[model samples]
Target: MTRLLIKNGAFITMDEEQLQFQGWMAIEGSRIAGLGAGAAPEQEISQASEIMDGKGMLFMPGLVNTHGHAAMSLLRGMADDLALQEWLQNHMWPAEAKFTGDDVYWGSSLAAAEMIKSGTTTFVDMYDHMHRVAEVTEQSGLRASLTRGVIGLCSEEEQKTKLAEAIQFARDWHGAAEGRINVMISPHAPYTCPPDYILKFVEAAHDLDLPMHTHMSETLAEVEQNVRDYGYRPVEHLDRLGMFSRPTLLAHAVHLKDEEIALLAERKVAVSHNPVSNLKLASGVARVPELLQAGVTVSLGTDSAASNNNLDLFQEITMAALLHKGVSGDPTVIPAAEALRMGTVYGARSIGHGGVTGQLKAGLKADFIAISLNKPHFVPYTDYISHLAYTARGSDVAHVWVDGRQLLRHGQLLTLDEERILAEAERCYQRLRG
Candidate 1:
């Protein structure tokens, strides 16, 4: 196994202690071997096969996006400034119906390139043609939890086919890509999926023993519709249908009530707060402070480029930190450290990768990024966490590594062909439109 040592770098270890120190970190194979404050020991320096200069760099765990539709990169700005239902039914669904596997591959490739350059090493993607997305994940060297999101609004046979597809995707790809990829069973949302259809997914999840992901309570109208149809709120409706029985990650989770928040905490459910997408679609803000207070794991996500107009998790981090303070009028509600953790460690936990990545600790996957700290936004560096939460942008990411492999170095992608992806993505979009 090759050993690499990086010394004289500032590290934000989002470990159990929330430790930040100027230190040297040792990497063996694909996992972090050791890291500590101050100088590297003589033995480690002598034994290292590669030594990297870490001067003027700030290293931290790569951001984890808990919810997104990666293949929707092609749909960026296609139908923005619309409500969720109109956006999905009239524009998104019709456009997606025309998407072939090749389209998904190119779109996902484009999204992967954007995410890597933006410092997101891990993400949870719920979309169709997931095998293409998985192919992108394998090629891009990004860690991901991929799901075949099924909407049961079609005929009975179509619904079964969709469910079967979702099941087969989970079976075929769960633990692929050297354990960098995992699978989940995802129903599109409560409004799109009937109770019986959702229960089928729940059963399939139990049979496969896989976690589930879904869109839940994203808008107030959806909540009212659930009540009109099922006499229960979205949370109670999903809970009644055995969705909360399995480990699940719910996207948006805006428009949740107090009881719904309590129930989510009791069920140990995780919420992926898509603040930008919610706000863009005129969806109300989630009760994040209350959710955190109730012990629900809250993580950040950019729903999709189509909706958010970008795949920048740094923007999501800043939005999550600032949105809550302004909405609740509590200046100290989500502090810088907490917002940063939500983007990294809490995101890992939400997507069921907590045991392996999300922190710069020994015995964990070497998934992290380095930002050039000499930039003006990072100037004065009084509080690194504050700078990261409030001022940092995705363009500041200078290098990225996942699973001990250098994917981006010196602001250049090492594994992916960014130019080709950009060109092909444009071609794919034109084809879809035509």
Candidate 2:
């Protein structure tokens, strides 16, 4: 097996102790062999087939984006500054209806390039044409949890067709790409799906034994609509429909109530907090401090480039750290370290990767990134986590690796052609506009 060693780097291992040290890491094939503070033993160095000098870099686990629609990168800025429903109904859905599988492929490729450049190794995507998305994921060499999100507001036959497509997608793609890809079952949302249709998705999830993902309680308007339609809030409605019966990850969740928070914790459902997207759409801030205190796993996500205008997970991390404190009037809430964890460790756990690639540890997948920390923004690095959460930008990322394979080197993508992706994305957008 090929062996590689990265030495003389400042390592931020987001393990249980949050160990930060100047050390070396050994990679044997696809897994981390060992890592520790200080110089490597001569045996490890001598046996290495390749050695990388990490002297000027800060190495940390790659960011995990818990929720996003990768193909929406094509729709970025296409229709912004609108409410979620308006954006979806008046603009997004119409354009998406005209999307071919090729559009999805190129758009998803564009998203993968942005994610790799920004140091995100794993992401969860829910969208249509997911086979194209999975193809992009396989080619880009990134880990992903993908779902074919079904909107069930149409006729009964159309709803059945969409659900069948979703199920076929899950069966065909789950555990694909050398175990780098996993599949999920998703109904678009409570407002879009009837209770009976949502129950069908839950049953499919149980049959396929896959996790579930969906949008829920993103805005007061959405919650109120759910209450008006179903006589219950979004959370309670979904819970009654048995979505929580599976391991579930909810996107947005900006308008959750106290009881909803407690119920999420009790059911062990995870929430992907999209601070930038919510703020952009004028959605109220999530009760994050309360959610964290309630023992619910809160992870960070960018939602979609159309909503967030970017795929940078660092922006989400910084926003998550600052947004809650500002709203709660508590400076201590969502400290820098916890915010960073939300983007990395908690994100992995939320997507059912808790024991996999969230941290830099022995026996785990070697999914990590090296940031050039010599810039002015990172100077006087009194606290690494603080600097990471407050000052670091995605452009600081210099190198990225997943499964011990280098995907980005010196901020350039190795597995993907960025120029072609950009051109195709533009072409697709123009086509959609017509």
Candidate 3:
């Protein structure tokens, strides 16, 4: 029966018709109870147990990062300026081999702190030692979709063991953490996972009734390698392998053709577009404009801090908005509103949440962020959507709420100890370096 009210503010519902109103929102428990323009219902305000003054703030749905490796925050800036294969093998993979569960816990703690303070309430994470990741997700109060990313480039016995672990993790953690955490089956990528091993993961996902997440067509080299090894591109190869038969989210898809895009749209597969990470890795830009035109669900992802150096969806949204225009040389491509949707509601849909949490409407989860519009950059707010896409940075976020709980307020964390997390992550990094 706990009721929270937010009033006297500028609210962007991001709902159908893309409404903007100067109004308030009421939260009854974890779901939004009411939202409107002008004045709120007197009875709703009177029943509120907690009231937050939203004056001078633009309240909108909390940002959703559809794909990331959360624990890789510990390796941020450690392996930069390298292509995919060299970076993964020479730098990331070797360092990751020495990691223990405690390392993952601390790293994930640090990552959660960064994300919460920056206004990302929900994110999809794929990495190893995911039990520790789940523990942190529960304690941090941030909603997350987590998976044990398996690379099946090992002995047959080793591959079997990894599959068992992935299944066990899916069994124990699906819809866990009071439903704040969701579990997904992840076969790291087409190149890393052989066809048979990936089929086993697909089978597990089907049995568990959960969706799948994986990297696909991230780079030209990877696509060429897929063709060389499998005699077909990843999209067709995976479709042939029955991956598209299940609900799947594919990360990257930077190298795609029109027919491939059409196939993905037909199969109802979603894509996670990591603009900054792809540019940094020289992975090339995704055919986002074409994909969206084909009615394919294209959402935003930051990949990992190690590559992009930050888990800021604002940056990704901005990149998606501007990069497409510059590359396509068309001003009308990926408008600000559409870019914002990709980072928020579209991202929620990609991770299987959709309208349940990514909008400011009644009955949706009370997962939204409040950004202070009092800054100089935000002055003359001719268009809030444009400001959010082109001018806003993560630091402008003043508050974040997920599932009716405040995780960050006044740019500080409420559910986690930031200093301790920073110290522990630093210690872990020191150990890794030593």
Candidate 4:
């Protein structure tokens, strides 16, 4: 196993105390072996096969995106400023229906490129033709949790086939890609999937020992529709259907009530807060402060490039930090360290990968990014964590590593061919346009 060392960098260990110190980190193969402030011992430094100068950079756990549709990168900016139902029905779904496996491949490749460049080392993707997404993830060198999102608006036969695909995808891909890729069972959303249909996904999750992911309570209309159709609110309806029983990661969750928040807390369900997409779609803001206070693990997600126009989790973390403060009229809401955690620590827990890749601690997988701190914006680095949550953009990412392999070094991607990804993505876009 190759040994790597990062020296002379400021490290943010998002542990319980949210500690920050200028330090060095030692890595053996895929796991972190040692890290500390100041110079590492001569023995530790001598043991490294490769040594990197982390000077003038800040090292932190890479941003974790808990919800997204990687193949929707091609649909970005095609439809904007529309409500959820109208947007999905009139614009997004119609465009998606024309997507082929090749389209999924190129689109996912493009998204993976963007995500790596933007310092997102981990992400969750849900969409059709997910095998292509998995293919892109394998080449991109990013850790991911993936699922085939099933919308049950089709006929029984189609639904049966979709369920089979979801099951097969889960079975074939879970723990694949050197344990960097994970699979989940997704049934789209409450409004699109019937109770029986959603139950099938839950059953498949149980059978496969995988987690469940889905859109839930994204809009007030969705919640009301669930109440009208199922005689209960979305939270209760889904709980009754046994979705909360398994390890579940819910997307959006923007329209949850106070009691619903408590129930989610009690059930230990994780919420992927897609603030940018929710705001763009005019969906109400999630009660993030309430959720956090109620002990719910709330993480960050960009939804999809189609809705968010980008997959920058730094933006999502900033939005989560600022939006809650603005909405609640409490400046103390979602402090910087907590907001950073929303995209890292809480995110790993949300995806059921806690203690594996979230924090900069020994024995954890080496999933982290280095941001250039030599810029003028970082002149007064009174607080590096605050700067990360408030001032830094994804473009500031200098290097990224996942599972001890460097994917982006000095702002250049090592694993993926960027030129080819962009060209094929354009080709797919032109085909879709025609």
RMSD, one per candidate, in order: 0.8, 0.8, 0.8, 0.8
The superposed Cα distance between candidate 1 and the true structure at residue 366, in angstroms, equals: 0.4
Alpha-carbon lDDT, every model = 0.93, 0.93, 0.92, 0.92
Over 1-434, each residue of candidate 2 has an lDDT whose tens digit, in order, gives: 99999999999888977469898999998999999988989999998999999898999999999999999999998998899789989999998999999999999999999999999999999999999999999999999999999889899999999999999998899999999999999999998999999999999999999999999999999999998988999999999999999999999898887889999999999999999999999988998888999999999899889999999999999999998888888999999989989999999999999989899999999999999999999999787888889999999999999988999998889999999899999999999998
* Ten residues in sequence with the least summed lDDT for candidate 1: 14-23
lDDT of 2 at 420: 88
CA lDDT, candidate 1, residue 287:
95
Question: Would you estimate the TM-scores of all the predictions?
Answer: 0.99, 0.99, 0.99, 0.99
Clashing pairs in 2: none
Candidate 4, 29-54: lDDT as tens digits: 99999998899779888899988888
Candidate 3 residue lDDT tens string, 1-434:
88988889999888976478898899888889988888768887889898888889999999999999988899999989999999999999999999999999999999999999888999999999999999999999999999999999999999998889888988888888889999999999999999988899989989999899999999899999999999999999999988998999999999998899999999999999999999999999999999999998989999999999999889999999999999999999999999999988898998889878888898999999999999999989799989999999999999999998889889989999998999999999999877
- Residue 433 in model 1: lDDT: 93
**Candidate 2 Cα deviation (angstroms), residue 374:** 1.5
Let me know the TM-score candidate 2 reaches against the reference structure. Answer: 0.99
Off by over 4 Å in 1: none
The clash tally of candidate 2 reads 0
Which residue runs does candidate 2 get wrong by more than 4 Å? none
**Which ten residues in a row are the worst by lDDT in model 3?**
16-25
